[model samples]
Target: MTHSRKILVTGADGFIGSHLTEALVRQGHDVKAFVLYNSFNTWGWLDQCAADIRGHFEVFSGDIRDPYGVRKAMEDCDRVLHLAALIAIPYSYHSPDTYVDTNIKGTLNVLQAARDLGVSKLVHTSTSEVYGTARYVPIDEKHPLQGQSPYSASKIGADQMALSFYRSFETPVSIIRPFNTYGPRQSARAIIPTVITQIASGKESIQLGSLHPTRDFNYIEDTVRGFIAMLESSNSIGEEINIGSNYEINIGDTVSMIAELMNRSVNIVSSDDRKRPEKSEVERLWADHSKAKNLLGWEPLYSGTEGLRKGLEKTIEWFTKPENLSRYKADLYNI
Candidate 1:
């Protein structure tokens, strides 16, 4: 919204990407959406995007892993918001090579293009998972990064790749590391959707992994706003920032809140298979988003315990709807 520029959003078809694309279009930017190409020619979550912004943005179907395609997608765009990557940690365990190919190599492709193109701004997406388990409370931008999982490891490589571009070639780049983001259109691989989908499917008891791990959950709206804030702020260039609520809640408590919002009492059955390996499990994550506030003048409206519940309420309402609920297979455990 700072000044309408030709903006290309990579991963614009995914959960947060779709919402961000719609938001940019709402702000009247000349936006191009780079979605993964599939045989069905689907645009993922963007297919169900809000009605008003439909057709306002252009779509470029291609794979992020393809450097040639990615370079072509970045052409004619002044700013690039790179959010495409492999994010599922469980699936990372099943297939680490894909994480390397998609997360690491895919990110390299973006950095190379951004550096070569001299894009006005490039905001790269990072994850709280790269911090692994917190050795201290309120993990900040300065906190040590420990890649405990294959997914996190690849992201660490990607984050460093972006930063190296900034230091080495002086590419206009900033990394926005967001904590657990949950909302409508989220896949069942995520905890909030996994629980909600199961409950919506009339399951009295739910299977879950470690419940002791705490996360600083940020609602999808706040996350999208954080992305936009970084996009508009020149001070964010060449820096890594954390976007989170700064409030921590355990998984068990989160489940209880979700159940309360849904007006149901449910039992949580422990599932070892669903859990991360003993050493790889990220025991806790609480974000210190002070850098975000200082740099971008941004903070979460849906913050703290009360805000989490409100966000959950909004999420439950969407997931309970027949049309949206039908999209997920809640009975089968999504890796």
Candidate 2:
């Protein structure tokens, strides 16, 4: 947790990963970012980061599914922040095998390498989806995990794999489960970005799926700070902590709020194609952050309205740009 120690971040090119990586650099940590390798030589969201922040990173491009590549990336790093995985639920329904490979097997690769290399700590990223629909409000760590979809199922496998490393091999590992983080650089596959991009693109009707499902949304900065707090706390080892705002809002209301924030008027159209299978959709999520506060002294700074307003403002600003808007196909549903 010392700034002097080197940290390796997998999925550094992603939305949360990029923000976390930039924050680490700004705090003067020795950062090595493991971005997914692609022939385009693109660094995804990392490329959108400020030049100064990107300059501080020791970027390594490789696939997390490859054990050899993962080992090479972890070599000499004091800690690992593993966030690489396939996260889209709709896509998982069609290509469950790839989800197994990337989410489960990729996590196995990180665990094996961390165990072998003697990393001080491995902060494995987890999702609220692993909890599925909350049987009770303000779900705690003790909540039962329901694999409602292949994506959540794969994450369950990954979370268990990380815990197994901690129990079996005594690997220094902690699970940071964040709920519905939204912010700039998020992909169109996510609802916030999907709505923002569609509205920014001048769409008159917003196409969406089931709007009744409630979610506990956390801002990017709060979620990133949760990761750091986990890394800094010795008590966090062998623990699974939830990082969320401990608030819930249904999808329809959220869309309305976004529209109000953007000062845009549009019709919300329920698209049959956007709805998830009845059994697979997670109906509600409300986090219990007491464990996180008790263990790591971590608490979210942004209220539900404040976080959504700021995050959406930033995201809308980004998407309003011709170049950024061009990257998204607002007319087409993304997964």
Residue-pair clashes per candidate: 0, 0
Candidate 2 TM-score, true structure as reference: 0.97
Span of ten consecutive residues with least summed lDDT in model 2: 1-10
Score candidate 1 by lDDT.
Answer: 0.93
Cα lDDT tens digits, model 1, 149-226, are 999999999999999999999999999999999999999988999999999999999999889999899999999999
TM-score versus the correct structure, for each prediction: 0.98, 0.97
Once fitted onto the true fold, the runs of candidate 2 whose alpha carbons sit more than 4 angstroms away are 1-4
lDDT of 2 by residue, 50-164 (tens): 8889588899999999999999888879999999999999999999999999999999999999888889989999999999999998999999999999999999999999999
lDDT of residue 126 for candidate 2: 96
CA displacement after TM-score superposition, residue 124 of candidate 2 (Å): 0.3
Model 1 per-residue lDDT at 62: 97
